[model samples]
Target: MWWKTARTRLDLGQRGMIMGILNTTPDSFSDGGSHAGVEAAVAHARQMIADGAAIIDIGGESTRPGAGEVAVAEEIARTAPVIAALRAEWAGAISIDTMKASVAAAALEAGADIVNDVSGLTADPDMERVCVESGCGVAVMHMQGDPRTMQVAPDYEDVVAEVRRFFEERLLSLVAAGIDAEAICFDPGIGFGKTVEHNLALLRALANLNVGGRPLLLGVSRKSFIGRVLGSTDLADRSWPTVAITAWAREAGAMIHRVHEVRPNTQALRMTEAILQGGNSAFSG
Candidate 1:
């Protein structure tokens, strides 16, 4: 499958491509303030790219549960410069993670290729127009509610079905609004509003999502749900678990993985790809 972005098309079949997450925010739940400046952010992006990430996803605002929103101008200030610097040296895909149209527009102007709207473009009415005008790839995600209250007693009759319905609606609406169907990818929003069970249910049902051939993007990197499931609070301990999930997701037919530590996850996906592609040639050696 191909994901068409603002400047180019990406081959999704290339070994479960990793979209490295570069959070340029001081309040993100994980890795906050680590790459808050342009230089630091650029350095990290370079490291991730060299580590085998096919795409770099930069986000300015903290979207952690109960996280407050950042202003459009402030968000752009945090992300646009970093995006510009990366674009200068990198020709690979760059994703701007923001919910506001103004922030997305500025990042696209500064050379971002995809808009990773955590709100799924439902928070900002102008977002649809901006995406249509820019022709950038979009990672439309599912969330039960806004970030501030998403996790407050989050409920789903059937988390997998509800998410699939959300994707179905978004695919039709976005295509009807002029986005090329190939330019859209569906993210189940793993930790957005899910309990441990809900998250697990979606992961197990990855191949069952009925999105009409669109790519499925999974971002479980360093998320709190992993900690909750593994009974570990240290963010450092979640790497292997995240990597394990990466391999599992890939085998389950996910095409894109959004991750914080790109190297290990990259290795996991690459190895998983190799094993899964083994033909029916019986082992003779």
Candidate 2:
């Protein structure tokens, strides 16, 4: 399978790809204000690239539960410069993670190749048109509600079926709106509005959510759900659980893993892929 973006096409069937997260905000649940400026963000991107990130996902607005909205101009300012600098230094894949069309437009103009909208192009009126026109890869995620109130009282009769239906509906609409089917992928929106049970159910049903034969993008990187499952709030404790899930998701045929910590997840992905490929007698143990 191949994923076609504006600037590049990824061979998803070859191996699982890691999308490094670069949150350029002060309020993101994890790593907010950690890489806020272009210099720091670029430095982190370089590290992630060296550590095996196939794509660098830059986000300005914090989508954490109850996160307040940032202005479009503010979002652009936080993301565009880092995207431009990364485009200048390296030609690898870069994604702008935003819900607003205007911020996505600025990021695309600044050299982003994909729009990783957590809203799945529903938050903004013009998101679909902008994506269709730009030819950038689209990641349509399933969130029960907007970030500010998503987790307030999230509910679903059947989480897996609802998400599956959401993906099916999105696939048809996105293709009808002129996006190439191959240019689109589906994300189950792990913790956006989900409880621990909901998140686990989605992970267990990862392979079943790939509607329209499109790839699935998994982003369980140190999310609160992980910490909750492990009975720990410390980010450090969530690291290995994150890696384990990365391996699990890959074995389940997930094409991409969006993660905050790149190196360990990259290692987990490579090891899982190698093991699944078979015929490697190099390890006798």
Candidate 3:
């Protein structure tokens, strides 16, 4: 499983890939304003790269549930400069986490390699054209509703099956719009519009998604669903659960993990990889 852009290539399934989340917003549920400025966001990207991140997912808008949308011009202003700086100095994959077409286009021009659209390419009709023209890697995620109202009533009958159907439909749409199938990845959109049970079921049934061998990306890092499960509303308390999920999901066939704290998640994935590769005991060798 190789994810390729004109400027980047990722060998998926060789090991779990960590996508460090850098939110340049004041309202993301976790670590929002910490890197809202160009300088700060660039510094954080450098740190994530040094910390073993294979990809940096930069978002200018907060997609956290009930979060208001940022204007396209504002979104571009927030992310493009950071992306440009990172591209000038860094040589790793950079993903523009936005649903708007203009923001994605600007980021690509400024040196982003992937379009991680939380809207699953359904937000702006022009999104498909921008991605097709740029030939960047695209991550189409399933959100049950818009950010503001998604959490208010995330209802589903057999959530896993429904999400798989969503992927099936979207994959066709994206391919028809001229995206190479090899450059496409699927994210079940955990916590996007899911209740706790919905999120867990999707994680459990990942192998069952019939996406024709595309990589499955999971981004449950410090999400509210984790808090709900752990009975802790605090964002900081979700790290352990986040790392635990990374290990568990990797074993369950998750090829990529989008996380905020990269080092711990990287360690967890490494340990899981070692164990899976038969490095279970000190004396085994």
Candidate 4:
């Protein structure tokens, strides 16, 4: 399968892609405020590209549980410069991770190639138009509710089936609104509003969420669910589980893995792909 972005086409059938996370906000759950300035953000993006990241996902607002909304202007001020610089510096795909159309528009003008909306294009009515107008790639995620209230009493009778149905409905809506089906991707929105059990169920059944034959993007790197499951709050302790899931999800046919630590996860994904591709007897254990 191929995902067509504004600037590049990703052939997902070949191998899994790593999307390095660049949180421009000061409050993202992990690695926030580390690349607050444009120079620092661009430098980090360069390094991630060298580290084998296929895409750079830049977000200016913190969507962590209980995080408040950022003003549109503030969000634009934070992300646009970084995206602009990276667009000029790097040739890989650059995605603007925002829920607001205004911010998305600014980023696109400044040189972003895709829109990764956490709201699934439902938060701002204008976001869809921005994407359609620019002909950029989109990742519509399944979030139970807004960041402030998503984790509060989150419930799902059948989480996997429910998310699959959501993807089906959104695909139709987006296509009808002029977005190409091939330009769209699906994300299960892990930890967005899920309990640990819900997240685990979705992870285990991730292959079932591949609706309309579009590619699936999994973003479980260092998420709170990993912490809760491992009984640890330190973010550093979750990398092993994160890499393990990266391999498992890739084996399950996920096309993209959004991660904070790019190098190790990239190496792990390469190894997993090699194993799944079947090896010579000499390389077998």
Candidate 5:
């Protein structure tokens, strides 16, 4: 798959990019309200960049299961300032994590490079138009349903196949709407409205998703699935599992990783890439 460059084309071969999550909500499932304020969020973004994050994903609303929706004005208020501050402070890519077109457009204007829409640009009717007009990178993700009721009892005939189909259809829609294919990326939406088995299946079959040759993003950082597998509900105790998932994703050809813990994930991906390139495979093993 190929990604667009400002002046040239870029290849994602065996390279893995890290996208640091900056939740600006006061009630996110994990680490909410910690970075809700603009100063705290900017500081965290700077730290993530220092720890080797290729992109900073700033989310205004909490999408955790059963979470309430934030007003559009409030969402804009929560995310725009952080995006603007990070754009001035950090040199790496900044992504606005919202499904609202107005919020995305405002963020791009405030200096965001990408739109990380968790709803796959289907939540808001004008999302596609905003993305197309801004010419920014777009990460289209697959979610079975809205966050409020998604995890109640999510089911799929075939998890991987359904995700692949979702990506294809979303890509086609975006392309038809005048967005360049290179500006697109596919995300499987790891914990959003999915069971542990479904999440595992999607991760195992991640490379099968063909979104018109766009990059693939995998986000499974300290999620509930790790807790479910390890028999722990504590988010803080899932760090090791998060690192393991990062390594697994690296070996599976994931172009980008959305992670909570940036440094460890970065180190794991770097070492995994070295091993895959035929360098010190024994040590990695």
Candidate 6:
């Protein structure tokens, strides 16, 4: 099914769309404090929209491994203002990158368009209810544990099968709770609970996750797996690698890419789509 956001209609079987990342936290793994303030975050969100971002994902708290949790009040404080400002200023969709149902509901009330729950709606019982009540879009991602220790010797005997099963169960739960399947998207939670090898395997086998026609949202921007492959620890220096992974995800049937760099990856997806669709002349130009 195709999910309609404010600016993009994601055809589940077609080429991928771009969801630009805008973190309001002070310690996001990448590009964190750079946009911590409301003004800075708003400015960056505008720039991303101008750069061809279809969706701007705004996160208040850092979900980096080993990062401490933020209070619900603080998370709401950090994200609502930016979400409000962006909704007023930007014409595209706004995805609240949060797990807390209170924060998600507040952001939605403040004009955000989607809820990107990294815990796959398992973190908070009220999460599904918020989505159902708001009728907003949701990206339910699979993370084995909390950010504090998700990477501590994470194990999966059959990663792809396990992830697919998890998505199936969660999708069933959401549907049973009255959430429309068309309003849902899924992310495999790259780097959230997987080792480098596990991450690679998931990426390679991403096409196997065609969950009854729901759109797939693949977010592998500047992840540690890229560092492991390229022998680089600096996240800022991994733009090219991120672009490569975005293209790979597109080829693997991902319907959206949550990314840090919008322009280059946008260009890459356009080219990749053109080529994949038999050199369609409209996209070629």
Local lDDT at 27 for model 2: 86
Runs of candidate 5 with Cα error greater than 4 angstroms are 5-11, 279-285
Clashing pairs in 5: none
How accurate locally is residue 232 in candidate 4, as Cα lDDT from 0 to 100?
93
Deviation in angstroms for 36 in model 2? Answer: 1.5
Show model 4 residue runs off by greater than 4 Å: 279-285
Error of 5 at 25 (Å): 1.0
Runs in model 6 deviating more than 4 A are: 5-13, 280-285
Per-residue lDDT tens digits for candidate 5, residues 48-71, read 888888888999998888999899
Q: Give a tens-digit lDDT track for model 2, residues 7-72.
A: 889999868888999999998887888998999999999999998899999999999998899999
Q: How do the predictions measure up, each by TM-score?
A: 0.96, 0.97, 0.96, 0.97, 0.94, 0.95
Per-residue lDDT of candidate 3, residues 113-202 (tens digit):
999999999999999999999999999899998888888988988898899999999888889889999888999999888889998899
Candidate 2 displacement at residue 157 in angstroms: 1.0
Q: Give the higher-lDDT candidate: 1 or 2.
A: 2
What's the C-alpha lDDT at position 4 in model 6?
54
lDDT of 1 by residue, 151-248 (tens): 99889899999999999999999999998999999999998988989999999999998487989999999888888887888988898999999999
Candidate 1 local lDDT, residue 224:
89
Model 1 regions lying over 4 Å from their true place: 279-285
- Give the alpha carbon lDDT tens digit for every residue of 1-285 in model 6: 588543355564555678999998888887778998789999998888778788889998898899999999999999999999888876678899999999999998999888999999989988988988888888999998889999998999999999999989988989899888888889999999999988999999898987867888999988888888889888776899899888788888886999998988888888788888876513221
> Sorted by TM-score, highest first, which candidate order results?
2, 4, 1, 3, 6, 5
Local distance difference test, per candidate?
0.90, 0.91, 0.89, 0.91, 0.85, 0.86
